[model samples]
Target: MDHHEGLRETYAGEWQGLTNSEIRARYPEEYEAWSRGEPVRRGGGELATEVADRAVPVVLDAVDKLPDNGTVVVVSHGGTIRTMIGRLLDMEPAQWERFGGLSNCCWSVMGQGARGWRLLEHNAGTLPQPVIGDET
Candidate 1:
């Protein structure tokens, strides 16, 4: 298991430790943009791209060290994981919100592919069952 401080969640700035209702009540505009998946300065906190910029290099460095078909388990905060996955798949930062947040202790699986990195699973908690008889 590897740990990096860059894998921490996007800093919530003054909103840290506040409940969603409290944040919504206090910063309605920022909360609205956040709920709508629009990129807004998150209370002068780090942007998604900024999170990716710091975290992606660490992830890529780890990936580079892996042997062929090797696996690495990365444990990270929900937003940071999403940003890293989006960046790995070459998705624009604006589309990072398309990926949903992960539940506590849930995880995502990614694999390198010919085209680039591919996400085999996202926000998953259970082991995947193999397809049977073409049943999807």
Candidate 2:
């Protein structure tokens, strides 16, 4: 998922507490452009692609430890989760931005069975609204 500077003394940095908007506003134009994937720009501090490169390995390692046909839940940030989705589903890295935001508390289910590891869901939105009495 996304990286954040933790409050722990060892993990904290001067810029750790700043939000994305703050980073964009305060940083140099090239930095912001890079972060945002602007044309011809190197982009900012870290790209989602880079994060995915690290996260997928750890996740697959953990999955390998689980029993066959077992179910696991990973509560992670949007970037991380989306990365997992793209990786598992054989989607391009850029596809994540195209899918748009993953709403808060949303989830995806992945399982390993006779068919091997697969994605059962991805960023499921809020439950569909029920029809009220007499609405029909």
Candidate 3:
């Protein structure tokens, strides 16, 4: 398994390690902007786009290494995974929030196609089953 610093979870700066209520109580305006999806950097932390900028390249690098019919699993936090998925699917960073947060141990799958990337699954906990017509 490869460990890449670029794939690390976003650094929330002043809001780091704080609980939900704590973040809401401490930085209401900033939190509100983020809640409205206005691209505010939470506590002067990285923007969601910035997170994708760093993370997508690392994931792409891994994808480039896979042999034919090989799969690469990316294990990361919810925010990181969400941003990466949005970027991978060519969605705007503002729309990335549409992806719901993942519970622990859940994973999403991305499939490459002639057109581009497709989200085969999201927030799944079980192993992948073969698709009836997807066989090569």
Candidate 4:
């Protein structure tokens, strides 16, 4: 149960922890660019790809440490989780928005398949049964 600092939430720079309204008021252009899926670094912070770059390595490291059939649970912020999932699935940064918002107290699951990593579930409320792997 160790903490991994790389799993922290997306660093939004000046927009860190700001609400939507607050961000629109203070950084309207940046917010609009993000809303339009233009890949703007909100508050001049890390881009989505950058967030994935930092977070995915931590996730992969945990997976590498697991014994055969072992499970690793990751608890992280929504934006970081989403970006990491997108990278694992090999989705382009432009496609990250296709992954929906993760509501409070929800979680997502990913599984390693023979092909690669696959999303088992997303934004789920209940604790999930661990996916040993997807051999098929």
Candidate 5:
């Protein structure tokens, strides 16, 4: 997810870390189109969509290995979390872009059930709500 190309780091020769305007000024049309679905052929870099594809399988593989009715906690970045949610909801890759971008220290709980993966609660932080026990 975040560690993947798009979010990881830009590797374009002379274009890395530059703003879009700077890239356009330096790299011309190729960089300008970077935001509008431009594919970073081979060594350039990967698009955000590509990163999600690489992340989904890793998450699913871990889930599959868990015992039925088992719970697992995934501590990761916003991109990784959103991508996982999109996969759980059976969303298309395009739709994955629309997943809620949760904040830091936030989490979403999903469950595997007869109806397949179901989203329980979204962005639940470590709060005392919905619980009776607390440090006395």
Candidate 6:
């Protein structure tokens, strides 16, 4: 298993370890901007793009080391994984929020296709069902 520190979640500066209510009470404006997907430095921490920049490379590097049919399992925090997916999909920072956050212990899957990378699943915990139109 490859572990990269760059895959760590966005640092929530002063908001670290605080509940949503606590952060909402303390940093209302910043929290609102965050909710709207506008870039705000949480507690003077990293931006979503910054997190993506650091994380995506690590993921790509791991992918490069895999055989064509091999699978790699990356254990990462939700925000970091989301950011990485946005980057991998060539999405603008604002569009990152379109991909909903993952529930605890849930995971996403991506596969390289003929066109490019595609998100096979999001926030999933079970084997994927066959697509309705697929024949195998």
Best by TM-score: 3
* Alpha-carbon runs more than 4 Å astray in model 3: 132-136
Across 1-136, the per-residue lDDT of candidate 2 in tens digits comes to 4233221121113345777677566666755554465532233234556656666776776667778655445666775677666776667766655554567878766654454555555667544343354122
TM-score (C-alpha, index-matched) for candidate 5: 0.57
Could you tell me every candidate's TM-score relative to the true structure? Answer: 0.88, 0.57, 0.93, 0.89, 0.57, 0.91
User: How many angstroms is residue 109 displaced in model 2 relative to the true structure, after the best TM-score fit?
Assistant: 2.2
Candidate 3 lDDT (Cα, whole model)? 0.89
lDDT by residue (tens digit), candidate 3, 1-136: 9888878898898999999899999999988888999998788899889999999999898889889888887888899999999999999888999999999889898888778998888889887787887643
User: Clash totals for all models, in order?
Assistant: 0, 5, 0, 0, 0, 0
Clashes of 6: 0
Q: Mind giving the per-residue lDDT tens digits that candidate 5 earns over 40-100? A: 4322664545665666676676778888657566666776667667766787656665557
How does each model score on lDDT? 0.84, 0.56, 0.89, 0.89, 0.60, 0.88
Query: Against the hidden true structure, what lDDT does model 2 obtain?
Result: 0.56
| Model 2 residue 105 CA deviation in Å | 1.6
Local error of candidate 2 at residue 119 (angstroms): 3.9
Query: Could you give me the TM-score of model 6 versus the true structure?
Result: 0.91
lDDT per residue, candidate 6, 97-126, as tens digits? 899899998999987776678788999999
* Model 4: lDDT to the true structure: 0.89
- TM-score computed on alpha carbons, candidate 2: 0.57
Q: Any residue pairs clashing in model 5, and if so which?
A: none
* Residue 105 displacement in candidate 4 (angstroms): 1.7
- lDDT per residue as tens, model 4, 10-109: 8888998888899999988878889989988888888999889889999899999999989988999999999999999999899999999899999898
